[model samples]
Structures are given as C-alpha cells and as structure tokens.
Target: MPIPSTLIGIPASPGRAGGRVVRVAEPPGEPATGPAPADPAGEAARIEPAVELVSTRLTARAATVSGDAREVLEATVTMVGDPALLQNAQELVTERGRPAARAVWEAANGFAATLSSMGGYMAERARDISDVRDRIVAELLGLPAPGVADLDAPAVLVATDLAPADTAGLKPGVALALVTEQGGPTSHTAILARSLGIPAVVGCAGASTLTDGSAVIVDGATGEVGEVATLDEAVEAAAAAAVVTDWDGVGRTADGHVVPLLANVGDGPGAAKGAADGAEGVGLFRTELAFLSAAEEPSESRQREAYVAVLSAFAGKPVTARTLDAGADKPLPFLSLDGEPNPALGVRGLRIARDGSGGDGAGVLDRQLAGLAAAAKETGAELKVMAPMVATAEEARWFVERCRTHGIGRAGVMIEVPAAVLTADEIMREVDFVSVGTNDLAQYLFAADRQSGPLAALNDPWQPALLRLIGMLGEASERTGCPVGVCGEAAADPALASVLVGLGVASLSTGPGARAAVGAAIGGLTLAQCRERAAVARAAADPIDARRAVAALDG
Candidate 1:
C-alpha cells in the first residue's frame, strides 16, 4: 500500500500504539417493533430484566474503572434504572397495549431528545442515552450491545467516538490504542484512556475511514497517525526532544536559573512513583481520591494516615497538598452539594468549604486540615496545604487562617479563578505560596466548556491569551515575593513547559509520565532562550500561531 496521509488530532494521552484498526460495531437499532405481543405483562417482564441486565453491566464497569470514567458509568447506571423512565415505558405496555420494545424505545428517545436540546454537556449525553437504549433493546432481543469486546486480537480502537459507556469495559492491552473522530482532553474517553495508559488520539476527523486490519502507527503525544511501516521509527527519530541522562537534583536552565521541577500526583502511591521517577518534590498531591472513594466521611485518623503516607513517600521531601478539591466531578457522599445546571462554574473547590452549610462540609474541611497537621507532626514532612477556588484575598486569608489554626504553618490558594489570578499579589500576602491550575483557568477565561471537542483547541496551553495570564501570575508572584508554580496539565507538555518557565513560573509540576521529559526540556534551554520563545509566543495571533512562533524560535 502507498503511504497513508497523516491525520492530526488532540493528544489526549502520551505514548505510542501500533496496530490494525478495530472499529467498535454500531448497535443494531430499535429492533422490529414488529407485531405487538399478545401478553403485555410478559413483554414487561422481559423488558425489565433487560434493563436490569444493562444496569448490572454498567455497575460492573464502574467497579472496574475509577476516576472520571467511573463517575460517568455510575451516572449511566443510574439512568438505566431511572424510575420515571421505567414508569413511562411500563405504562405504554400495560395501558396502551403497546409492545414492550417500542414503549422502552419511545421513552428513552423522548428523554434523549429532551436532553439533546439542552446543549452544552447535557446535549452531549444524548449519545449516552442512545447507548443505554441500545444495550437494553439488544439484551431483550437476545443480541449483544455493539462493541469490540469480543474481538480477540489487540488493535487500535478506531471509530467516530466511543461513548464512556462503550469504553468502560476496555481493559488495558485489549486495545493497544484508541483513535476517534470526536473527543476533547477532558472527555471521559480521554481521561479513561490516560488512566489505562492506552495511547490515544481523539478528535481525528477522518479516523473513522481507516481501513480495518491496516497496520497504523499512532503517536499519542503529538496526535499524529499514519499507515506506514516505518512511521513509528520515524516518529522516534524526529522527536528532537532534549537529551536526557539520569543526572538530576533540582532543575535549572542551561543559564543556571533555578526552577524546581515537581510532580503532580493524585494519591500516596502516586507520590512514591513520582519520587522514584526523579521528581524533586510534589507540586500537586491531590487529596480528593480519599474522599471520593470513601463510603462515608473519612475519619480524621484515616485522613491523617493517608496524608502521612503521601508526605512520607517523598521521603521527607517537600509536598504541597491541596485540601479536598471536590464538587461536581468529585462528589462527597456526606455533603449535600446540590446538582447544578453547570457544575463546573457552580459550587466546587474552595466554594465547597465556603458552602459549609450546617457545618457538614466545614467539618470535612477542618478534619482534613487537622489530618495534615497530624501527618506533618508524625512524619516531620514539610507538607504545605492549599485551598482550591479561593476568589478574594479574604477567602485566601480565611483559608490560610483555617489551616494555621489546625497547625499548618504554611498555606496558600490555587490561582485558578481569574479573579484570584488578577489578585494574586494581594492573596499572596495572606498565604505562603501560589500555584496555578491552568486547566480550569483556561476554560473559565475562554468561556468554553473544557469537555467540548470543538472547543478543545481553545483550551490549548500555547494560546497567547493563556500565556498572558501565566505572565500575570508570574508577575504577581514576584511583586509579592511569594513562590508561584504551574501545577496543571499544561506543565506536562515540554514545549509548553519551556514557555511557562520563560513566562516567569518559578516551578513546574506535571504528571509522573512527563516529569523527566519536562525536566530534560528545561535543562536544554538557557533561561534567556526560554524568554525568547515566550516573547515570540506572547506576540502571536492565536494558539496555532503562538506554537509556530515558538517553533521558529527553536529553529
């Protein structure tokens, strides 16, 4: 075969996967609503059992996957058993003498259409609802839900897109890669693929057209895909990443400007893994994993043990821990966080601490703080605590004081909210340090939903607008004499990491996978060269132009 044209897409996960394509089959649609069954009761019994089966399937999937994918699957499982949906469908069978299949189909379709019209995140769920309907209908018809699970061979999953539900049962190595015509960095597919360490390229426009069994080289880091025998070898050769040798202590530019490199970890084991990977310290040791998995409110002792384990993982190295950053995506079962029409913008982060209605949420906050203090006392770990979603200096001060009262000597606020970024200088006066969570900052600044595939480009770290904000935060840090850091997914991109360091970010923290890549990238450039790239990038018209400008500087 002639060389295949390369397809560019968003790099949702970093790695390489090479294989033939295995397109997940489309569901057999609304099976013949053929001739109504004489007994509606028998149809109801069959339909209900099918629905239960789908629910059971989803629950099993949820148990298998965690983090974002687990949340989406659990939500789907609930949708399958929705009493309102079941009642409406059963009424058609019992009262209107309609076939159970048609009744369930119409009910699901009606609800799906209503949800689709809502637009934004909810509109995206129409596909999810449709998937649920197909699964139920397929089970009732003695057929299986359309999927690639039965495929014995390992291959790259190529399709228009795999719904969260569709991809839930995907085990690592079952599909060596995942390429789709649509998805964003924050999509469930992207999150799940990354968690599973499956190299993935999402939002590949023509990916669905790739011939089945055609060997392909998928580069997840750069979102490049092609059908060439030597593409993998060529990609590795062309990487041109900075030379990396295992000789690291603290990270510094060639010009010898000290800019500490750190790791963004989610759990205790993650901290140890990051340390083993040569991370000097933890930049973002997320504490939400403990609460999210807890069946009830975790005791102070439990929280302390968890905190101590992570702090000790670094072997007494500095670890910055963010207190319970939960809300929409990370729900606390004990807290009554009401569902929001758009939870991303609504109550989350430090807002939950402020949401301390009746003190249930407040107690969780205090308990967490006390645990950090206990851990610090027990392990002698230099644990720095920070609060998420602090908007004003007052909120910053309030958070600092809360931590201080709990015996935390050092505290800070994440500079994610634009207001906080703009007021970083003042907020820093009330805290010990500042860290920017650029993912959310970019989303809120651009007013684009992070999960929207079309809006994915807007969330690019190279965007001149986002660079300007990082520059502002850097300025704020210097003006206030507070240590400022970038602890976001943006820090994981080596090229972008170089620009971020140039933009005045004092430290960089990234996922464990990128720690060495970023450290190596930073080591190759002189401080002045980074400044040059940053200057060229800041003058660009858009993200693409900014990327080009920076690349030209490297050239």
Candidate 2:
C-alpha cells in the first residue's frame, strides 16, 4: 500500500523543514546458533577490546557536544563501560564456551529485560541497552556501529527512535529535521533536537512507510507532514518562526505583570549556556548528573564542587536545586531500591528518603543538603532547594526542617502527584515555594507512561485534567502567598507559558533554546487575555479541542 500524503504526530521541537527522507541504518541482528569456541580463554580476551572500542567511540562523540547532548552521550558511555557487564559476558564465554559476540549480546539483553520490566523511566533505559548491545555486537562482527550514516546532503532523518550517540553526533545545519515512528516529547531525539535547534516530529507511525529520497515537508510546531507539494508553504512558515525576537533578560506581561523566566540546567556548562541565553535565573538545577557516575555516595566536597560550578555561573541569581531525584530510571549504586517490579510508582523521588524505607535515604538527603549549603556560602548565590515526589504536608514539613537544619534558608517541594495538588494548601504553608513538575503530574493523572508514543496525547501538557491540576495549585499559591513555578517540558511551549501565567504560576522555567520564544510569547499578551485563553482551553473536551480553542482566540 502507498503511504499517506499527510501524516500527523506529536509536535516535539517546534520548527519546520523540507527535505528528502533518509532512514537510519538497521541494527545488527541476533547471531544464529554456532559450535562452542575451541579456545575459551582466547574468546574471552576479545570482549575487552570490543568494549573498549565502543567506550572510546562514545567518549569522542561526547566530547564534540555540550549541555544535554553531552550528558546523554556520557551516560551511554557509562553503560557501555560497566565492568560488571564485561565480567558477565566473559563468564558466559569461559563457563559455556559461547561465542564472544553471542555472549555479549545475551548478557546485555538480560540487563535490558530487567530494566524494561520495571516500567516507566527505567524502561527508557532498556532502549539504551539495546543500542549498546548492537554497537558491541557490530564491533565483534566487524561491522560499522549501527546508527545514522554519513549524509551526502541535508535530509529529514527518519528512524523508529534515535540512540543518544547517534543523536549527539547530528550537526544543526546538516540534519535539517527529525521524524520518528516512536518516542514522546521527552525522548532523547526530542531533547537533542531542541538543543541542536533542529525541527522534529516524533511518534509518526507512517514514517516507516516513507520512501527513501522522497521529498517531504515537516511542521514541528503543528506535528504535520505532507508530500513534496507542500514544501514551499512549509519553508515560508519555518522562516517566520525562525525570526525569533531577542529576549532582553526580563519576563513580564503586556500590561506590566512580572514573571520570572528561568532555565532548566543539568551541569556547569548547561548553566553557563542558560545564563548566556538571557535567562534571569536557574529554575531547575538537576543534581543527578554528578551522582549517576558515582560508585558510592559522592562526598560532600565532591558534591560541593558540582553545585559550586552552577552557582558560580549564575552568581546572585536564584538557583533552585532539586536534591537527589534518584531511583526508577536513575538507580544509584550506593542507594539501591532493587527488586521493585514497578519502580516508578514504587520508591522513587522523595519516597526514596521517606522514613523507614530500609535504606540510608535520610543520610543521602542530609549530606546533599550540607553540600548545597556549603556551595551557597561559597558562591553567595541565592539557593532554593526542593524535593521531588512530595505528596503530603508531612513530607513537605519534614523536608523543610531538614533544609533549615543544614543552614539552607529556602526550601520547597515538587507537586507531581495528584494528592499534592488536592492538598496544596497544607503543603504550601510548610515550604517557601512549589514547582509543578508537569511531566510526571500528567503521567500520573492520566495513568499513561510519559515515554509511550501511542499515549502521547493523554500525556500532553494541554490536557484539561493536567491544566486543572495546575490551576488548583495556582489557587493554593494565591491563597497562601507562596510562589508556584513550572519547571517541566510543558513550560517550554510559548503559548502554554501564557496560559500558565493566567493560571497564576509565578514563573516559567525551560531549556535555554526556549527562553526567548517563551518570553516573547508571554510579553505579547495581557494577564486578562491570558486568563481568557486559559478558560477557553480548560472548557474544551480534549487536548486537541483545547489547543484549537486557544489557537482560535489568538487568531
């Protein structure tokens, strides 16, 4: 059957492009059964070089990028270089005389299966494992690493999903846009595409049917794709969106209501980029990158250095640091939450440090707070620390006390659970501020996995249920005189930023690439106009209707 003329998908990184489709290279297939190797010792020795090759290649790729792209690549390198995985593969070769490639494949798959079964964020890691497995197997088989090949010219890269290494290697001007058959808004493809300033449309099921070298137009803003005939129109629309008005390092509405625009940063370089991009402050300073690679709990001095880099980058500006949001997708070696089939709903986020979970979570939290306080003292930057997964007033109060005990003045909690929204009044009084983590809130509210492509609509930020939850928290903020900010992927959407303002959110935090667009979007609308649009959105029956209703108002 012929492919459709137009394809609809989730709008990931917003822009538009026209190019011929170029699919990613196929991954290595499983090897057929073969006879046992004659020299097990020699076969085991081959695994080291193959592993080293994958690690070295990924390290080189990682060095070429910075910010989120570099972080994701470094993570892949860590997975590939895990000593336990190499040891396990060697055991298979020595004990059962399995071929080196097959042993590596089996060992990697075993780990991937365990991760996939845990569901949610951890499940995404399973895909990373598959990518690593293929690369290692391809090395053993003397084939090129499986991923995007060298493009002779600019084109729209189509794939089921891109591995971090492949996505990291993409250059802004060469890879015009990205279209994927799977992956939600927060996938590696989407994150890297935004960082690289490339337009992208993901979760397009029809992408697999696109013929190679066929010209097509992709609208990353509207999630629309069409045949070559639409190229001229798409090019014009893209040009208009590309001409973004420069932000002047302030966030305010047309009628002069102030809103703080902040950046979500991962590390020192990311923070520096955010500051350079005219970000007023650091909104979501993810403190997990330093811990992800640690074999044991990072010492206070080590953690202080990590925090100091970001603090120094944005000195005197407010930097809200989230403490150790580990478990689920990011399980630490020192702080184990093993044997949980459903880690997402189980002990994740703030639940990890909750009383009586049979782990040293409290110690972890205390030491992290001490390091953050020390960084704050050294840098003289305004530091506001928050805990993720706080669903009750008790958790809020407990976290605040811990922060105060460590000499951290400002403390807050993330409103990611439904209960957090419903009981916002009590929780607000216990903390200095609250930040709505819309990604997790949408996932839990709709009971859909945030990473699932087919369920992307339900997990969309425009969903009325999610909006209403934010509205509820907004009301609580107003009543208690506590500030509420949004620090999720949703906050990056320009139109949504206005709606959030109308909903009484005090600040909007997003990636560096989005700061200008979001600031300009809010600057054009009055508070009253924003409220009217928010009402129009909340009155709709579904996300599609809500988006259309709000767009109609803009027209």
Candidate 3:
C-alpha cells in the first residue's frame, strides 16, 4: 500500500529529518485557587529567581547563535530581565492582591498587549516578550515550555507555532522540514528558515493530525508538505531536491549581462550575514530595528553602534541604510502616535520625517539625520541613506536638505508610493540615488493591503501597474543622472530580476538565496538586450504577457 500523503501549510525553516512525532500539547489548565500575593515585597522575592533563571537560559542560548540570531536573542533576554517589567509585575501583585504567578502573568500579558496595541517595532518586541514570559512561566511551574520542540533524534518537526528562539535552537542537521499549523510567509520562522536554507511549510491546518512515525516529504520551493507511506520514497524525494545556496556575485540575463546582487539588511548582524553569504553590499539596512526593541528612544551613541556594526561587517562595502521609516503600521511606543483610521495612507515614511510632529516628540527626520551623520563620522563607512514612502519632489528636497544640514553627503528616497513613481523625475533630481520599494509600491498602486488575505491578487509584484511604475522610475533615473536601484521583493525574484535590470535599475538587492540564480540569469544577456526586454515588459498589459516577453527573449 502507498503511504498516505497529506498536504499541509507551515512556516518554512531549515534541515530535513525523519523521526517519530513528538507533539508538544498545551498544558492542562490548573484551577485558580490561591489568593493573590498580598504584598509587593513578597511577590518580588518569589518572581526574582524565575526571572534570573530565564535570563541565564537566554544568555546561554545567545552565546550559541551567530549573526542577527544572536542579537535578537540577547535583546529578548534584556527585555525579559528589564527592571521596569519586574516592577510593574510587583505593583500589579500589590494592587490586585493576586498570586505571585498570576500577578506576573497578568502584568506580562498587559505589557504585551500594550506593546501589541502600540504596533510597529514596539509591537514586534512585545510579542517577543510575551513569548519569553510564557517560557519563563512554564519553567516556574515545571511545565514543558511552549514553542520548545525537542530534536533528540532525526525527525520532521510539526508544531502549532514556533517562536524565533525555539526556531533558532533547531539543529539543522537533526531537524528535517518544518511544518507548522500557523505563521505567515514574513514571520521570523519563515525568514530564518530561508536564511538557513531549510525546507518548510506554514499555515497548514490539521497538521497535528498526522500520526507519529508517519513518513513525510516537504518541498520548500512549492510550499508543500505531506505524509508518505514509505520512508524510501521520502528520502528519494529529499535527495533529488536541489539545495539552495547563497553564493553572491552579479546576476545575469539568459544572454549574459552583469547585474549587481545585494542584500537587504536591517542591523549589524544582518549585514555581517549578508556579507558572509557573498552579498555585494547592504541594499536596505533599516535603521529602525535599533529603536524598535528598546523601551526608550535609542540615543545617538546607541544608533551609532548599530550603524557602525553594519558598516564594519561589510568591511567598507557600500551599505544603503534607509532612515527611520517607522509610523502607524510600525508604531514606536517612545513616539507619540495618534491613531489613524488608515495607517498605510496616514502619516508615515518621508511624510513623518518631513513633518517631525507625527507624535514621536522630536521629528523622525531630525533623529534619523543626526543618527546617520554621527554614524558616518564614527565609522567612516560609505553610507547611502534613503527615505521611505516618498511621493513627491518637494518631499525629496526637504529630505536632502535635512541630510545635508546634519552633514550627510549621500541621500536618496524610496519610490514606494504611487505618487513617487509618477513624479520620479522631479524626485530623483533632489537625491543622489533612488530605489523602488516594490512591495509597498504594488500595494499602493493597486489600492490593496499587502497584508490582507482578500487583497492577495493585488499584492502580486508583477502586476502591470507595478511594472510600469518601475519603468517610470527607470526613466526618471536616466533623465536625472541619478543611479536607481530596487530593494524590494521584485528585485530578489529570479524571474523578474532581469526585467528590473533591463529597466535601468543599477542594482538589485535581494535575499541570499536569489543571488546565484539571478547571477546566472543576468550573465546570459547584454545590457542592450536587457534594455530592449525591459521596454517590451513595460508595454505588456498583463503578467502573462510580461512573463511571455521575457521568456521569448531568453529563448
């Protein structure tokens, strides 16, 4: 009999294994019989050891990982051990008269809720803290920690949810493909798995229904996971599948034309990892990562450390660091943010920087300019700072003036807003370079929320309108003598990379896995051929036509 095969979705991660299933079910609910802690002093004494233990575990784990993985873990540990969080717990226990455990749980939950509601970077940090708190609480109660998956043997890991820390602990050699019942494509697990070159599937319902010891196979390329009757068949499939590598260089067209391959980095570790993976340089180093994880606004020194780390990691290679782009979608708690009915359209990106009054006290523009200037002076790194969500020439001019006032010599703006694409010529004249953020560009062009399931169709980067936008930006770059690049999903896409290069995008920055494939593609074409192909792509009315045009050119 053939092995029963079932398809399921899960967040992607690295490695492949075959072992008996080890389901980590949620712990049974314990009754709330005990009264709340009557005193803050008593609660502090009770919770201190547990917090210390969590800190120790986190520290030990942080020491084991490399690159951004280490930074994120260490940051999480710091947040977990924060005095404010502990004091808040103590206060809750004293005021509510709840049990020590209950007080800590409620306080942590409240904090997490506050962070989540705050949105943007703070919310992401809040979620991290909540995860840590759950693990700490489990340790205190002697319960199996949530998100912990044991990898004592070779096996495919199945989980309802896997936190970043738990995912980091996964031994690539022992663990096979990861299948999860929940998580999105952009989730940390998915991003890490892609980084580690692991096969994973996410968002699969009823994944837990599969029996232990059932044979399985996962196809990361196609996002498929299923049970197999025979282990031999599974192994054969795994063996036959090609592993993706991150060897960087320049991308090429089918006819052989060079296209620089770069990496999108958010922090120092990310830059280091990208460099190690052979990224030509940092394509998009989001400066906001440093500020998001902290409870307080990051000082200039703190900002400098982050900027220097990234620049040093690249060893003097060019790093296009985007200035603070935080706003409604990515709320900063330290920044005073007024609630907006439509955050995507509201004050964000270059608008926030220009206005300087979008609730975060001092304008984001001032802080970003100061940070970039300080980082440049400290590291002497070849820094190219850009603004996000810029839609007009005037915004670009204001941004350039601010950068110059702070002594930043190189400045640019991202063309993500549709208005920017339409007015690229005017905008390009005010900056040193331009990079299209096609993800947001596509969403805004189609009037769709890229994050919404109902708007999936509109989120396609290959949509005709988005391609036209790229063409328009390219035309502006030509007219203004500004070097344009693309640091968006479309840039990393092997299928679309050639088209972007052909459209006069001077550089294409993407995730590591795409480097070689793109290099191979671009290596096959000449610059003129790419230009012609890009012209054809611009004229195409639909995705199918665009793909067909490129395919015909290759053939």
Over 293-395, each residue of candidate 2 has an lDDT whose tens digit, in order, gives 7889999999999999999988898999998887755778887666675677888777788845528988888999999999999998899999998899999
Rank candidates by TM-score, best first: 2, 1, 3
Error of 1 at 523 (Å): 2.9
Estimate, for each residue in 1-555, the C-alpha lDDT of model 3 and write its tens digit. 111346634224333434345554453233242565456577656777888887898789888876556766777788788898788767766766766666667778777877665543455566577676776667666677676555677777777766777766666656666777766454556656655545666666777786667778775433456676677777776666544533336555544545568888887767777888788888898887887667778877777777888888775667888887877767777766677766667777666655556664335567767877777666666778898878788878888888888888889988888887778778887899988887677777878655433444455555667887788777778888998898876665555777788788889887665566666556666777777778777788875466567657756
lDDT string, candidate 1, 384-421, tens digits? 98888788999998888888788888898898778887
Task: Name the Cα RMSD for model 2.
Answer: 2.9
**Best candidate, lDDT:** 2
TM agreement with the true structure for every prediction: 0.80, 0.93, 0.78
- For each of the candidates, the C-alpha root-mean-square deviation to the true structure, in angstroms, is 4.8, 2.9, 5.2
Instruction: Please list the residue runs of candidate 2 whose C-alpha ends up more than 4 Å from where it truly belongs after superposition.
Output: 1-5, 35-45, 119-121, 230-237, 240-243, 336-338
Candidate 1 similarity to native, TM-score: 0.80
Error of model 2, residue 136, in angstroms:
2.0
lDDT, ranked from best to worst:
2, 1, 3
Model 3's alpha-carbon lDDT is 0.69
Evaluate model 2: give its lDDT. 0.85
lDDT comparing candidate 1 with the true structure: 0.77
